[model samples]
Every structure is written in C-alpha cells, then in structure tokens.
Target: MIITESLDNKPAAVTLEPLPDGTTWLYLRKNAKQVEADTGDETPDAKPWQCETAIGKLGADRSGETADTINAKFDDWWTYAAAWAEDEPMPTVQEQINAIYDTLAVMMGV
Candidate 1:
C-alpha cells in the first residue's frame, strides 16, 4: 500500500496490485464497512466473519502502535463516518475526502 496526497491535499490509501508484466496500478479504498451475503441452502445465516469493518486493515498499518498514537483513532470513527455520509451538522474528514475524490474523478478522469 502506498499512501499519497490527493489533489485536495488529503492523505488517502492506495492499494497496489501487480500485473503479469510486473507493473502495478492504484485503487483508492477509503475506510468503511463491507458486507456480503452468505450462501447456504435451506437454512439462512449471515456470515459470521463478514461483518468486519476496516479497522483490521488500519490496525495492520498501525501495528506495534499504542491507541494514543493516532488522532482519528476510531474512538468515534463510526459515528463520524456516518454523519459525514448523511451530511449532518458536522462531517468528518473522511466525508470531505469523498467529495475530493468525486471532483478529482470528474476533472482528472479517474
């Protein structure tokens, strides 16, 4: 993963994947929750481990660091993300980040 600043001057996560020719490309994956349906016949059940958020990935990036090492350390990351999503009274930096991405995508053909 390579962290770089967007045109909006915000640090964003860029995941790099290698191609067969030994080249790589970047994809922006902001912190958020991802859910997928479970597959089982007859009986219905949600996947137990599928309810995870992006904290694990963040945690990996912050390995060997204490809780106090970071500012936006998820103490209220969920609420912040939600408020930003709905455009409430106060939005988190992550929400602002989405807007930046939208603008960049349109202007820069991302």
Candidate 2:
C-alpha cells in the first residue's frame, strides 16, 4: 500500500509492504523533487531519502483491519519514528541571517 501523508505539514510518501514473516515494513520518503534532483534519479518510482522500519507482525485477528485502522497505526508509529530520527527543522530567516553575520564576524577576526 502506498499513500501520501503530511509530515510536519510537508508531503511525504508512505509505503507498507508485507514480509514473508507476517511482519510489515513501513517506509517514508519526503521531498520527492529535492530527492530526485540530488540523486539525479528521475524515474517515476524513484525513492530518495527513504527511511524504513519494521512494524510487528499483524496477527490473524488484524487480517480484517480496515484501511483507516491501518493508517492510524502507521501514523502513530511514524510519529514516534520521526521524533526519534531527530530531523532538524529548517532554520528561520532571522536565524540564517544571524549565522551569516556570525560567519562574517569570524572571517573579519571580530
């Protein structure tokens, strides 16, 4: 199953693949355009910046789980994984300017 979801308000592609062992693997890829540009992979199925983790085996009882239920579970796991990944948020404009100023100050031996 492949779905597009918002992570931190940014579009991300999430994929769920079932393994032979009954466990499922979940993958998340963000910024398709940037990833394609950076990797020079323009294929339609190109997966860049993809991260994956195994979701425990789905018991027989869960075989009839609805799409919404699966999505909810994925969201919960993804949220925790995202937090654990500790991806740095983009710096604000003011922060960028301060960084530049700090660099210049050091360059000029201030």
Which TM-score value belongs to model 1?
0.22
Please give each candidate's TM-score: 0.22, 0.31
Scored by lDDT, the top model is: 2
Q: Candidate 2: minimum summed lDDT over ten consecutive residues — where?
A: 1-10
Q: Summarize candidate 2's per-residue lDDT along 1-110 as a digit string, tens digits.
A: 23333222233344555667654444545334323323355556544442333223344444554445556676665564455431366599999999999999999999
Q: Give Cα distance to truth, residue 59, candidate 1, Å.
A: 29
Candidate 1 lDDT, 1-110, residue by residue in tens = 22222231222333334445543332333432333435567435543222212222232333433333333344344333223321235468999999999999999987
Worst 10 residues of 1 by lDDT: 48-57
- Model 1 RMSD in Å is 14.5
Clashing pairs in 1: none
Residue 25 in candidate 1 has what lDDT? Answer: 35
